[model samples]
Every structure is written in structure tokens, then in C-alpha cells.
Target: MRQFSENTFESLVADTQFIRWAKGEQVADSQKWEEWKKNHSDKTREFDEACKAVRMFSFATPAISDLEVDYLKQKAFDRSKKQRNTLGTVVWMRRLTRVAAVLFIPLLLFTTWTLLDKKQLETTYSSLVENRMDEEISVVAPIGTRTIVDLPDGSKVWLNAGSQLTYPPIFANNGRTVHLEGEAFFEVSKDETPFNVENFGPTIKVYGTEFNVNAYEEEEVVTVALVEGSVSLAKSGGELFLEPGEVSFFDKSSETIHVERKNLEHFLCWREGKFIFRDASLNSILRVLQRQYNVEFELSNPQLGSYPYNATFQNESLEQIFQLLELSAPIQFDYTKGYLNKDGAYVKGKVRIK
Candidate 1:
């Protein structure tokens, strides 16, 4: 035989089967219902009394209403006057109807208020090991853009508009290990074995390397371009190395790896808040702006895509940047305060390079 108290009733009501039964979608066997009712007779009566109290108390009005005062007096008299067979099945069915009639309006208002509110929940995990353990990790960034995180060891990372990077909470006892997804630029702290960045299946082992890694899930290839220092790239168990001006592309889907030489500065210029474009197309430049300033661009001119420019700015306002770009480019840019309607002060309309 199973037993249930007040605490268990809340959980029992939370179950899908109980909810269906409560809603009359399905009914439990008559024999089982009778057995459960008999075991919980006393608690069921107490639960009804508490529910009646909740239904009667009105926070909006500090003082009890005349009807509520009358109900309270009658309840007291009923308890004092005589023993009543109110815990029986027949009485329970009647009590349910009366309770719903008294509480329905307030209960509906409470449910509506709860449904409209936003709820945020967070979870954390921790581990303690007597000896030691080695592990690899990965993370999925949320739907929208987020800022890059600077590590404790003076290393800088610029996460792409939407991407996740996961590493040990503390660096390994023997090595510095981290993983990246989407895109990120790293100015790593020099270590003995260097700092290693692994994505997909390939690994970039470097000694103080300044590089940008684009491993976006939509893209078939993972590109790691070295701006400074040496980086070793190993793909599909094969190892290839790069010098300061080299770029390596690994096809994660097909495992085809290629290494090329390139101009490192044009690719790694975001570090100074500069949208450095050697000959970048308008579409490509807007993508960079969208990530850098957290803005949306509606490009109405198809001709704007092919125009190219090179520029850099630090500590400049978005309006100033947009003014400069408008003078140099043929396209016009407009501004609007997106999401201002939802969060009044969160993001204001300030134009950047158009």
C-alpha cells in the first residue's frame, strides 16, 4: 500500500497521469482510487481546509470581505458544533465543486500572471578528484551574439558573433588546453608546450601565436591563420607546420588539409577594434560590423556588395564611423533602435560604418 501526505500531493498533481485524471482526460481504476482515498482521508480534509484559506485571503484588499468573515465564522461553528462525515467520497465530490466555485476567478488570474513572466534558470556542476583526471570539453553558445571572454592568464579571445569556447576551469596540471567553435582570435600566453587549440578533428599547437580560427558549423572547412609565431597543424593523424605568414585550412567534412601563405595583418586587425579590409566586399564588411558593434544592417542596394575599403578606428563613436564610411562609399545607411520596444534602455540606435 502507498501513502501520500500534503508534500506528496503537490508532486502527485504534477505528474501527467494525475493531471489527466484531474482534467477528466482519464480516470484511475475505481478500486485503486477508493484505496488511495481511504489511506489519505485525514490529509485530504486538511488539504481542502488549506485550499479554502488560500481562496479566501485577498492580498489586494487588506481586510477580509463580509462574505469571507461569514464563511470563517461558519467554519469555526461547524468544527465546534458536531462531528461531520465530510471526509467520505460523496462529501469530497461536493467539496471539489464548492472549492472551484469559490477559487476559480482568483486562480485564473494567478495562472495568467505566472505565464506572462520571464523565468531564468541556471545550473552549475563541480567535481573533486583525489588523484587527477584528463578531459576534453565543448560548449554551444546561445542563439544571439555574445562578447568574447578574456582568460585569467592575460590571453585574449574574440568569440565570433555566436560561438562557444570551453576549457578547463583551471589549466591542466601539465598543459594548457582549450577548445573552440565557430570563430575566435587568440593572443595566447606563452607556455612550455605552448597553448593548444583543438576544433573538430585537427589541432593547432602553438608557442605564443596570434591567430584567428574560423570553425563555423555551417562552413565545411576550419581555417587557422597564423599572424605571428609558429603553429603546427595536424589533420587526420597527419602533421603539417606553418610559419608566421601562413594559413592552414582543414576540411572537417572530408579531412583534406591545405596550407597557404598570406598577409597576416589584414586578417588579424579586429584586435584594435579596427575593421581592416584590404579589399573586402560590402557584404563581408557588414558582417564584420554586425559582429563588432552588435547591430543589424538592411542593405537595400545590391550594388553595395562589391565596394572595397580599408580602415581602422579606436575609441570612435558609431555615428562618426558611419559618417566616414558614407563619405567613402556609395551606399546610404539608416538607423533604428531595434529591441528598444522590449527593453527600453538596453540598446540605443547609434550608427556604425554603413
Candidate 2:
């Protein structure tokens, strides 16, 4: 038997057991079922949550069958084939091909469809709550994960770790207002609502602008770096405007603000799938890495935290990323098993020079 990592366990369960069950295979007596629950508790919890969510819905119930399953498989295969052929082709041709392959699946064959019409309407509304959910024109990142959220207005947001941006699911009647926590970069679309991002320390108001924001809490100051157009920063009862190639730092503790001009590419590199560092300390770089890779480190040598380096890595593997780091700084790392305690699995990471 081989030791299974988190990625392996997740892939096995999703690919083998789940697919077989969906395809109507006899899986109740399989050893994989037990192993799946044992190795991946998160997947088990997610399954349970999904079941609970469906139980709350008053609308149709769907069941799987052999013929229907075969049809779906064929549909998926055909869709994939069409997509491959349509790639690098004209958009209208792909649209026509998709229209030719459409199939409809009914929700449920319950005899009480009319009896639960009102209840179904309510359930439908609840499902769409996220539809009306506010999406302010701000960059938002999750606490431990990078959020690649697409805005309701067709704009894309690359949110960093330990940050969150709150906006309506769709743009509202007036403007876009998003609240931020840690940091994120934005490539805004030209919309009607003046885009405004309110960070923990300062409020950044903009309209159809590109910028990078570094306003992580516990830092000495909040920084907003603009790459294009103009941004307005309001803090401590004062308003300051910034232009391209300029950066603003506001000190919340002291109620002071500092503005400077610098190369915009240095800050915009992360959005391009690269990490650019110029004389950045190990600790500073680690902070960004933790956000990007969702990994934590236990520095064995406290002094190693102060080591500074300048480098850039774009779309590099973990091995490549670490090798690049080692080229400039002497350090070693290991892939650790997730911590398994009474609460299940949690990540544990460490970094040191050997």
C-alpha cells in the first residue's frame, strides 16, 4: 500500500467513486467508499452539506438512470469534441454548434408540481439570493485562498489571500462599492457606477482604473498603487488623488499619509502570474508566498527571515519556485502531511535552511 496525499485522495474519490456512483454503478459494497470517507473528510463533509442543501429545496427531485446516464456521457463527449474544434475559431460558429447540441433535463416527475408552486417560487428566490448579492467594484481575496472571482459586469478580479471584497452580485443602479480586507489587484471595466473600494484604513474611489492595493491590517501603513487612470483616497477626514505611476501610503495609527511615484510594473507583476521582488526581505516574500500558495512556514532560523533577495517567478512549479528562492537564499522545505487531529485535517508547513 502507498501513502496517499491530500491531492491524491481528493482526485481518487472524485474521479473513481463519485463518477461511478453518478453513472449508476454498484458502489455500495466497494472498499473505495470507506477509504474515501477515511482519507478525505472534507469531501465527505461537502457531500453531506450538498445533500442538506438539496433537502431544503421544494422543487423537483432528480434521479439517475442507465439510459439517461449514457445520454449525459454522450452529451459531454460531444460537447468536448465541439469545444475542441471551436477553439481558435470564430465565435458565431461555436455558438451555432452549441445550439445544435442542446438537450433539456426535467427537474423532477413529482405529481405535486402545482401543489408546491408557491413554495417552489420561494425556494427559487433563495437560490438566487447570490444573484442579487452585491458586487462592489473592489478586489477581494479570501483569508487563506486566492479568489479568482468574475464580476457581475464581466470584469475579472484576482484577489490575494487574507483579503475580501464585497460587492453586489450584479452592479446596482448607482455605482460599484466594494469593501476590502487584505490586498488585491483590480482591472476594472468601464461601467456607469463609479468604482469605489473601501479598505480597512482608507477608501479608494475610482472609475474604470487599474491598480494594486496593499492594505493588509497590522501593517504600519495602507498602500494603494495606481497603474492607470486616477484614484481618490479618503482618510482621516482628508481626500487625496493619485495618478499613474504613483503610490499612496496612509498610516492609520498616526493619521498621516505619504505619496510617492514609482515604476508601476513592479506592483502589477503578480496579476500577470509573476512574483517580482526587488530587495524584498525573506519575511516579506514569505507573506506573499503564503497568500499565493496557501502554505505556512515555521522558520527554523529566525535570522533567515531578514535575508533579502530580488527575483521573479512566473507560472513556476513548486520545485521551480523553491529552486529560484534557494538560488538567492539558502533554504530547504518539505511536503508535509496535513495535520490530522480530532477536528480532521489541517495544513502544517515549515521553512528552514539546512
Candidate 3:
């Protein structure tokens, strides 16, 4: 009934009750051992180590019968008695070598188990990745709505109004790739794996970069602006590289690409609920407002499209924006309520600017 902390490896191996518990041979002995371990929390680590060693030896040497186990215990006891009587180093060394030879089989098994366990874990992880690659995921930012999403590879994306993003559940084996429909600002994670964003007419590839992509299918132009870091725009004919503060424009109709140096803040401002326009044409500005408010617009004079406007707005109602537009320019707007559809739901309102 020695305390668990005071028990030595040799003592634990010699005890028949401990051996039966370690080998899980007796349910009653296992229950008692578990209770003892719970009461002696400080000795748990040592008890586990000793039990594991005994179990390994028992499994490795399954052919060694109970009679052989008793014979080995007797021999160990006799060696201890001789050491106490004579204290002869040569005799003790010989007996120790014989005991080590008997334990060598378990040591080999332990090494083999360690290697096999590592391989099994690696195989399981690879299988998990392969399974995840076949799964797809998609997120959409509806009209008049903006959203922030976190990608599988720890990248963050701020999706603008009327944008759709499609990607895999887990980016595995090859690289990270996503499809964009409207507008999104990406703060991509830095990694060895390349990240690709495919749009309508161009595919943007990046190592690690923060950039904004505007590829609204309705628009004639697809543009990618680099806020920081570098990106490559791959088109049908050639590939173009972009530096910080540079914008790449791809004309879908002409199948041509061009890059320009401009202030990227203007392009990325929409992600923060701000619409910034610098000398933008009135018609172009109306289109943006239409998308942001999910409203229809009609101009009484097509010549108003030639007028230039510079403005910045944040979280403003449609009436407030129109009021500012009226004050800044010689224009008037008639706002009308929308009509109900077949399902009896009112659609978006229309605005007439003259």
C-alpha cells in the first residue's frame, strides 16, 4: 500500500495488481486505479508514464507467460538481495544487461508506434483537405447593402452594394481563388500561396496585397486599383502588373487594358460607407446613386449628362443627396412612389432629374 508518488518503476512493474491495471485485464483493478489517480492528482503524470511502459512491454512480449513473469520477478528480487549482501559491481552489471535485453522488444514497439502515429495523422489531414476542395461557397451583397466577409485563408473582404463573391469552402492543394461580380475591397493575408480574383474580363493575381476590384457586369469597364502591395492583371492576350496607387482598366468591348496612376482612396471610399466623386460626370454619378439607393433615375435633359460634379456623401438619405445636388447644380428632381407588383409588394421608387 505504498503511496503512488513513492512507487518506483521497478516496484510498479513487479506489482501484479498494477500490471493487471496497466494491461486493462481486470475491470475492478482499473476502477480502483482510476480512483487512486483522481485522489493523487500530483502523481498522475508519473503513474501514466509507468503504466504506459508496462502496457508496451506486455503487448510486445505477449508470448511471455505468467510463469515467465514470476520467474523474472524472482530473479530481480534475488539480484537486489545479492547487491545488498556483497555490493559487487561486476555481478550487478551482468544482471542489468539481461534485464535490458528482455525489455528491448517493447522499446522497439514504442518507436514503431510513434512513427506510424505521425504518418496516420498526416494522411488524415490530407484527406480532409481533399474533401473540402470539392465544396463551394458563395456570398452576396444585395442592393443598398454592404457586407464584410472573412475568407478561408484569413483574408478580409468588404463587399460593396450589388456584389457577389464565390469561393471554395477551403482553399486546398493548389491555391486560393475567388470570383467577383460587382465591387469588393480585399485586404488579403500574406502567404506563400497565391490569391486570385476572377472578374468578368480580367483575372487579378496577387501574392499579398490590398486592392479594390470593380467589375460590375452592367458597366462597360472592369477596373482594379491597388491600394498597397502589387498585383497582376491577366487578360486574354497579355498580363499587366500594378504597383501601389495604380489602377488597371480593362475595356470589355474593345478587349484592351490600360494602367493609370491615381488616388486609390477615391476608389476604396465606398467600403467605408462614403461615396466620393472627383469631377465625375453627372450621368456616371447618377448610376452610382441608383445602385446605392436601389432606385431608378430618369433625366429630362440628356445634356445634363455632360455636367461635372464633385461631391462626397456618407449615410445620407436619397432626398438629402438630391437636395445637395440641387444646391450645387441647376437641377430639379421629382421623386415618385413605386407601384406594387403582382405579389403586392412595392418596388423601388423612381427619380426624375431635370
lDDT of each: 0.66, 0.71, 0.86
Best by TM-score: 3
Model 3 clash number: 0
Candidate 3: where are CA atoms >4 Å away? 1-135, 337-344
| Greater-lDDT candidate between 1 and 3 | 3
Global fold similarity of model 2 (TM-score): 0.54
Which lDDT value does model 3 have at 267?
94
Error of 1 at 245 (Å): 2.6
Which candidate's lDDT is highest? 3
Better of 1 and 3 by TM-score: 3
- Which residue segments of model 2 deviate by more than 4 Å? 1-145, 153-155, 170-174, 218-220, 252-255, 330-344
What residue pairs clash in candidate 3, if any at all? none
Q: Residues 77-193, candidate 3, lDDT per residue (tens digit)?
A: 999998776767776888998899879889989989988998998887777677766667889998889999999889999998989999997787478999999999999999888
Q: How many backbone clashes does candidate 2 have?
A: 14
Judged by whole-model lDDT over C-alpha atoms, candidate 2 comes out at 0.71
Relative to the true structure, candidate 1 reaches a TM of: 0.48
Q: Where is model 1 more than 4 Å wrong at Cα?
A: 1-163, 172-176, 189-194, 207-209, 214-223, 249-258, 301-303, 342-354
Give the alpha carbon lDDT tens digit for every residue of 2-118 in model 1: 454667566554455544444344465535544655797767654444444444543465777899999999999898555455456558888988998779988888777666542
Could you estimate the TM-score for every candidate? 0.48, 0.54, 0.62
